[model samples]
Target chain A: MDELTRARQKACAGSRLSFDEALLLYRKASLLELGQWARAAKERHSGKNVYYNINRHINLSNTCTALCPLCAFSAKQGDTRGYILSPEKVAEMISRAMQETPGLTEIHIVSSLCPDTNFSYYTDILHTVRKLLPHVHIQAFTPAEIIYFTKISGLSIKEVLQHLKDAGLSSLPGGGAEILDDSVRQIICPDKASSAEWIETMKTAHSMGIPTNSSILYGHIETTEQRLAHLFKLRAIQDETGGFGAFVSFPFYPQNTKLAELYTIKPLTAWENLKFIALSRLVLDNIDHIKAFWIMLSEEIAQLSLAFGADDLDGTVGEEKIIHAAGAKSGSIMTRKKLNDMIVQAGYIPAERDSLYNIIKQAVPS
Target chain B: MDITLDTIEDKIHSGQRLSKEDGLALYSSNDLARIGQLADSVRKKISGDYVYYNVNLHVNLTNICIGQCKFCAFGCKSSSDKAYELTKQSVLSRIAKAAEDPDMKNLHIVSGLHPDWPYEYYLDIIKTIKANFPLLHLKGFTGVEIMHFVKISGKSIETVLRELIAAGLEAMPGGGAEILDDSIRQILCPNKATSTEWLEVARTAHRLGITTNASMLYGHIETKEQRINHLLTLRALQDETGGLQTFICFPFQPKNTALEDSITRTSVWDDLKTMAISRLMLDNIHNIKAYWVMLTLPVAMLALGFGANDIDGTVGGEKIMHAAGVSSQKALSKNILIDAIREAGRIPAECDCNSKIIRTF
Candidate 1:
């Protein structure tokens, strides 16, 4: 059999596909065939259950020292649009969120690397939220924040993560791992976090028993081979430690970002988005979940992604900021009812999850 | 019972008709490129590397319609400010301008159900347009319009269609088929032809030697099941009559319509997947048209690989979809459509009204 046919057979048969086999299937096999196999593979992990979470994001600040041209949310230190939220304000917001959403299960917090703020500000936000909403899962501080904390406090990556974990950091939200290649990172986010730094921080978090998700920001200047290579790299790490909880694939939105006008990059099509979802599902078999983040993809394609091997639809984020800054019109504040309806409409059970993959509730379809 | 793409491929390869379950499985599959490949394979079996376009003129005769479908933006009530009917002189003059192009092979006409016009009004318009441009093939009116003529003129559908053929109406345009299910029709379009009536008109037209094209207006409120049922209905009719010359799909333009607030435009994913599924389902139908007027230029070009073989026409000026907030050109200039077809990596075959190729680029 040809390489593509063999890839197709292995993928559809629920067998592990090598990186070369995945690339061949991804490029040469029919898109529907890949999705068919991807869906089966997703069922193997997720069954008929599609996951969502009731979460609220507490953005610490948009004032950043590393103003990555790829980010539309980041602003320079004295910019008119920049503001840093104090720990008191974060505590107030968390209380308001609990009162507003009594069922809020996760507190998803990721923010910019503020210029002059000491590493204490990062641990303080986690401490305040953890103190108030003691049981709510705290998925805070991506590797970018960890690496930044290391730079500011002169602490090791492991030491920084241990401090944050002691202050009640539950897990890490997977962000700031844009393309996971230094070549692409050099141009897109040269100052924020290097690829190696992000992975080292993640490995450190895993060693300390703090689980995290893996991700790649795709569809920018990255080639197809680069995208596949990034997935393989994640797979290799997952095989080593099995620390990654989920793999989230984000399509680069090039609306308000400088990377858009600099190269005139258009937002990737839904076809490409679905292909990436299916490809990741097939290649990253070690990772247990593939999140179809509705903020990045609209609700329509996000729901449609369930059939394309996406088993998780991220969360019903009370409001989102990062991608919306790049002109995402997917709106803020998705109700749990809306998430359940979308999941049910896609012919799956609605699984409400916490920061970890523990199911809080599974809605039985009427 | 676990039907897969492999099983469906087996059916298609051996020339066996896909069952309804098979069609549903294909629609539900997320592997679009694979489904598109199957559709393109079917398309290549019929016409290899030859994508067809026509130098035809679209003249929507009137906007005053009684079938005020919730999904439609063009059909205005008779008392509405936007309601307007065209006189014979106005329509003929419109055609006269486009008739100057020696390659203009078809004068396509479809309009809303004007309340006051007699059946002879339509007959008289067709006869006059045919007489003025003897070489232009008159492919006008839809199955809905034909049924409307029957209602107003108090004649049988056969008589109405026969009189139309006599008046130089050589073929019919496929519109007014929202979804071939009455449950949807009752909620969206209550007054138009029901599921069976649309098929009956096509059946009668095919029996009388009139060329017809089948179509569906999707992306509003129809489910995949309804979409497949609609296609299978057309496939069954085409199987019986072998009359439909082209199968067209108009992704519903919900802008400026009643469903605008509730409905959003379907993604390119659904559009191309449906196009490919239609090509795979309707095996008997020889042509599948990606009407650029509804699906803009880039999507139509992409549809060429997804089992669509015809771009409908140059569309000298179409007001129905344009009124419904379509942004495609009213009329493409000379060789623009040709260049577009060439850019899609297919030979542009200039076709006549029934999609008969006259010349190829």
Candidate 2:
């Protein structure tokens, strides 16, 4: 039989498809067959469910010490547009959310690796959120932030996580895991956490039972193998701790980033985006979910991903700065009804879920 | 726009708790990616990168049922073509074969309400397995089956559960909770246990210290509000008892069953959304499962990202979902499961009946 047929047979037989076999499938398999296998595999677990959540995102500050070339979101401390939301300001934002959207389940807090912010400032934000909205889940900070916290606090990673957890920090987001390989990290985010540090922080978090999400930033300054290696590294860590909740892939948006000057970067094609999502499904078998971030992929492609092994459309983000800073024009905010409509239009069910993939509400297609 | 998107974003950033109305507004909003992002954020907070599974074998003791629920394709009349009950020897043999695999840590046994079999027969099945395989965790019986046993044996729900526990029943499978609304249950499964009875059984199981899983079968005649109510009810019970280990959802599959013509199968989107919403709503429940058999493996894997942290594992000889025209593999090899979990970028760990990790792959 041909390689595709052989792979299909192996998949059908419930056998583990080898890496080479997966590579072959990626290179040679028909999109239709791949989608069928992916959809079948997805349905075996999620069935008709497509999960989304409602929450606000807080990019604590744009000021940073490690201004990675791939980032357009960060600004130097004294830069004209640089500003940090103080703990009180953060509290005001969260209180307003509670007053407006009483069902708000989470507050996603992430930021650049700002050198000016001390560890206490970070913990203070957590404390403020907790004191104001004790019931809301606080999903804050990234590995990069943790590493930064360690530098400022002079504490171990474990200590930082403990303090954050004590301050009512719920969990970690999977940002700054742009690429797990050192080579890619150096090229993309050199001043940030080394791949080793990122993995170490995540490992430490998992060991502490602090669940975190995983992500890969691709489509810039990386080879196919580097991307594969990034996934493999994440898979390896997941195998070790079983702590990661979801794996999200962000295609590089070169619109106005510093890296755009050094190298010409074109956006990933729809085919490339879908293939990455599908391959992620096929390769990251140990991980339960893959997301097509609609902010990066656009609504059309994100909807198509339901068939391509992505069961999540990210969420009804009110404001997202990172990708938009990089010149993403797909608009930062989406309404819940619009998200549901997209999923329904894509012939899948639209579900409103929490930060942790819990179902908040399920929308039936009309 | 009375409530601009910015207002919601401001509220969320301020770390405010969302009310039911706010939740409805967010659920009905036009931003799909933002909702997904929020769910992803919640998923990261609760489950982390570890996607849990177990190496277990499903052994259905019998398919014969007295109640002909409209959505059930596995149940049959005693005289039906698929009606067959396993003898004690046969059941023991199946367990023996399954136990031969050293990794087989759990034996999940759910059966139809056999009219002829006495309570002793059911007890014997568990006793036989436990007697032969002491190390194996035996997770058996749904709320419906427990109710059936209670009726047949004239025993209280607690008494039946206690007896089953004594006979090696480690946990209760959260089945037959199709929808906790009596109106829908009357239409879908009138002859089965009422919503109260199912909740009572679950509460009894929890009270006896035998943790149970909970499930919802949606996409039939139930409205979205009813679905939300069902989740809220589950959350309230979980708050009271903390007896639920996981909350799983089944999309209504109408094929080769009495409801086939009346209701079509739920779309995969609906299934995914339900799982996500369940994760968001059922905050007290830690684990949410995506049953690959009913959902298909791809959707289940995608569910890992949506909100579900557990995929009910390596089901050897699964029958109920298959009876409803499920086309996925009946059983998955441990390696295949590990690979699937790894492929999804999650940690794959073998869990016992209680969702305790046995080994990480």
Candidate 3:
């Protein structure tokens, strides 16, 4: 029998695919075959259901100290485009989105590593959203953002997570774990958190009864081995903490970023994007959900990914700025009906989920 | 930048009819994303966010066929292993099972041109189905099947269609129009009705005020120009009659057929581009369906964002595409279909066979 046949057998038998076997499958297996295996794995966890949440995304501010070359959303403190949203403003946006979409269940708050903002700014934003939208789950902060908080506040990551949890932070959004390799990060986001720092921060959050999502920004300066190492690192952490909610694979969109000038880059094809999503499903056995962020991959490719081992298409994200600054063409605001329709059309049940993967409401067919 | 967007984009924005050359230009362009965007703009302007589907069941009466189409695997000779025809009782039983669902609104019936079964045998099946399920919208028979009935019954096209209508055939389905160009048709489906005959039957049905859906079997041996010509021909017919309710584009599935070894299934890229360009070319047709059974649910859902407003319906027991090696489920539940449409971020509106909105979710 061929190596691929052996790998398929191993996968069917529920044995973990080894690193070499997974790399081989990523390199040689047909797209459809890989999709079938990934779909099987996903079905074991999620069944025929794909999950999304009705959430509002609040970017607190664009001002940042670590102006990563891969980022176009961040601005200098005096930059005209940067404005720090006050706690009242964040609360008002959350209340407005809740009024518009009554079923809104989660508030996603992510922002750049701004030096001017103190730890209270982050905590107050969560506290304000929690107070105004009492029923909504507060999913905020990345490990990179946490690490920045640690530096300025002179507190441990665990202490910071505890304070934020007390202030109504529900979970982490897993944004800045972009390709967890220090070598790649040195070129793309040198001033950001190191691989160890991000993982350690997640471990701290998980130990404090806090759940967090994980992500990988690929198709940029990262090597295949580095990509696999990133997945392995995430899997190892999940095996230890068991607190990760979902794993999202973001294709590097380098349209207006400084990274575009340093490296000649091309956006990943639909085939490559689907292949990576399938691979993420096969490799990250401990991670329950694989998310296809419709903002990064156009809605079309993201919808096609439902069959290729993706069980979550994020949410009806309202007012996203990070991806838009990096040149994503799909509009940030997607209606709840539109999100539900995309899931249903892919032959799956669209379940409205919360920050902790709880199904708030199962979709009823018309 | 590979596709110069000056003329066609301007025409689309200005609401002008696209000529055949413009259609060919849209097809040949490599900028699929831009083409999809333009088509999406048109889809939004035409259908808005409403994506239409139906609760329907497809019943193929027989697989025994006289024509020897190279791209078909569903039809068989009388002596072949898969040459069984459904009896009237079996047909009734299928319809009864379909009617058990309260929302089942349409019954779609199409079949091979049986060599031995008389025209009454076909009309009786429709009569029995309609008598049993009175409220079900009976959309039955293709233009080629109509022509075959005309030949066997010794009647004119209009009379044959009228007889079927009297027997409870409410609408016609556009099948067997593989390509409008006779050169390709001569090689692909020679024994089937010619392009002129197919259009003539459709025109007759339209004149009689019988609504019908048109289809094109694309991505085969036909050229880009031939594909455009097929759309233009349908547009011309719709302009004259305005009876075509929707135009469905079926990318040729070449599996387990005579041409399986020589041809392969078209790429998703081509399937999407063709659906978009068809929307751009067929201006008069109100709905463009990306048939989920043929294109798979994922591509079909994506097509909603790319100029396709209808994903057909909750098709039960679909055999034609399954015979051509479709891996998707033959029968999709109503909930699954609705969820698929909603997940694609479009409102899923349940419609009848005539494309009238029954309910929107």
Candidate 4:
């Protein structure tokens, strides 16, 4: 019997394959076959209805200590380009954006791992933003940044999260979990948190009821095995914590860095990106949401991803800065109407959601 | 059952040299498994299943452009109310801000063909950027900007790119070639870089040992054949120069721009089809990108299965498409980006511009 025939039989029986077997299946299976498997998995998990929400970002600072090579949104201390958002600035940006967007849902907070910043600084910023905007959900901090805060404040990860939680940090945005492989970290971002540290941060956060997201960075120098390893790492952690609410896949945009010279960084093709999403949907059975963050992928592609495996179109973001600095021509700030239009265009229902994937309003198109 | 390595090689060769009829046959065949098998075989053969993306940021030095292309909602007149340009100091500052991110490895610089900026100014800008952040890759200047620089510098495209390369220019962003059809160019960007001009710039860049990317801005008034022609143009250029690295397929965003009055907008079906066809059509190019900023993130994830490999990095700040009124989510953090890719089920490894592995966690 052929290898694919046996694999098909195994897949039909609902028997999970080992990591190596899964890789072989990924490589040998046709796109149609892969899609079929992914679709079946999606149907089994989230079903046909995709999800979207309304959210905004509040970056506390662009100053950093670990200067990773692939970053386009950080600044060194004392650089004229750096601007750490004071509590006032953070509150004002959130307040103005919330006023502009009536259905404003979640306020995502992240910042550089600045050596100068203290835990109180972050807690103060979060508290002030919450004080002014009482209704908005505050999903802030990555594992590494939180770890940095904990180390600075002489608190445990759980204590730091609890403190922030008490101070209006309702959730966490998974930002620092770039390619969970430490070997790759040694080359691209040696100064950043280690792979295990990032996972531990997420695990700790998840245990504390702080639902967060997880992510992967593909198309760089890591081997295919490394890519799978990253997924398995996230999967293992998700299995343990159940704290992860969503999974996002981001490609590297290499336009101006030392790594670009060593290699020519081109964006991944739509098929490869979608295949990954579909595969992620199939593999991350424990996770509830698979978000195709429109900031990283185009809207058209994001819409099509609904069929592939993604179930979430991240909320309407207004005026994003990081990806733009990297060479993104796509602007932030998608209207509810436009998101509805795109959702309908992709043959899905336009369901308005809150930060936690709750259907706040469902618009049935005429 | 008898498919050996030799048979696979033959199949790869056949798929590599596939005709339009072959593509249609594959598209129409009920046996999608077979079609994908063939395509996957081709994919594995050429690039060895290694999809490419980069950690880069885009800095549009100036949105004030001389040519008011019909399709361009981003470019504005220098005297217009929406005109804005980054100064040397500001541009350097933006670069510095971006360089601080450990995951950001490439700097993408594409701008309008400003009428009055001296050639020396462009040269100095590249030199200064390289001098400060010597570690970052400078993928500066689009083809249209390059053409403008050539005209202003009184040098050939080769000499111009060479000088820029010597001054820390690493590669070229394949921009300003709306469509390789002169007729389409006349209608959209009449006074912008000509089809031949864009091709020559890329070809010259490639010949000078600098790999450049090629782009097709579809979903406007261009025909299907025009899309094919655009791909064919890039393919022909690749055939001759071998300088082109990847193909980026951008849909014309008709929002708050001059063209909005004439056209309604591009549908999502057509956009996905274009991205899929790009993967099927461009056999030689190593990568195909579904730029999330223009298309949005959801569609980008969908494109992964259709024929794309990359879903771009976290942009620090973007302006051109915003001026044009193309609303996509901007500033994605590394975590957000990774989560999106992982949600798609593909392994997300942070990479540099040249597809170098950063981290695979």
| Model 4 CA deviation exceeding 4 Å by range | A1-3, A8-15, A261-267, B1-259, B271-361
Question: Per-residue lDDT of A1-366 in model 4, one digit per residue for the tens?
Answer: 877777665554445656776677667765556655665666566655567878887666778897778777777788888877777777778778867988888888777898777789888987897888787788888887988887789998889888999998888887788788888988777887889888888888777788888988787777778887788888888877788888888877776555666766655756677677867766677777888887777765676566566778887887677766677655677888878777666556777777777789987645
For residue B184, what is the lDDT in candidate 4? 82
Full-model lDDT for every candidate? 0.86, 0.81, 0.85, 0.74
Q: Per-residue lDDT of B133-246 in model 2, one digit per residue for the tens? A: 899998999999999999999999989999999999999898999999999988889998999999999999999999999999988899877888888889899989999999
Please provide TM-scores, in order, for all candidate models, with all chains considered together: 0.82, 0.54, 0.56, 0.57
Minimal lDDT window, size 10, model 4 chain B: B26-35
Model 3: residues with Cα > 4 Å off, grouped in runs? A364-366, B1-361
CA error at residue A282 for candidate 2, angstroms: 22
Candidate 1: regions farther than 4 A off: B1-11, B18-62, B69-74, B81-109, B118-139, B150-171, B178-190, B194-197, B204-210, B216-233, B248-281, B288-361
**Considering TM-score, where higher is better, how would the candidates rank from best to worst?**
1, 4, 3, 2
Interface RMSD of 3: 12.0
Off by over 4 Å in 2: A1-366, B1-23, B26-33
What DockQ number belongs to candidate 4? 0.15
Q: Each model's RMSD to truth, in Å?
A: 5.0, 22.9, 21.5, 13.7
For candidate 1 chain B, which ten residues in a row score worst on lDDT? B336-345
Model 1's CAPRI class is acceptable
Collision pairs in model 1:
A31-B31, A31-B34, A32-B31, A32-B32, A32-B34
Task: Please give, for residues A1-366, the per-residue lDDT of candidate 1 as tens digits.
Answer: 878777778988988888889888877875556677888889899888999888998788899988887889988888999988888898888889999996899999988998869988888888888889889889988899888899999999999988999999899988888888999988888897888888888887888899999999998898888999999989888888789999999889888887877786756766578778999999999999999999988776787677689999988787578889988768888888888877765668899988888999988766
Q: DockQ of every model listed?
A: 0.23, 0.01, 0.02, 0.15
Taking the tens digit of each residue's C-alpha lDDT, what string does model 3 give over A23-47? 8887777555666677778889898
> Could you give candidate 2's per-residue lDDT for residues A180-292 as a string of tens digits?
88877877788888899999999999899899999999999887777877887888888899898889999998877888898887666554776688777776777777888
lDDT of 3: 0.85
Interface RMSD of 2: 9.9
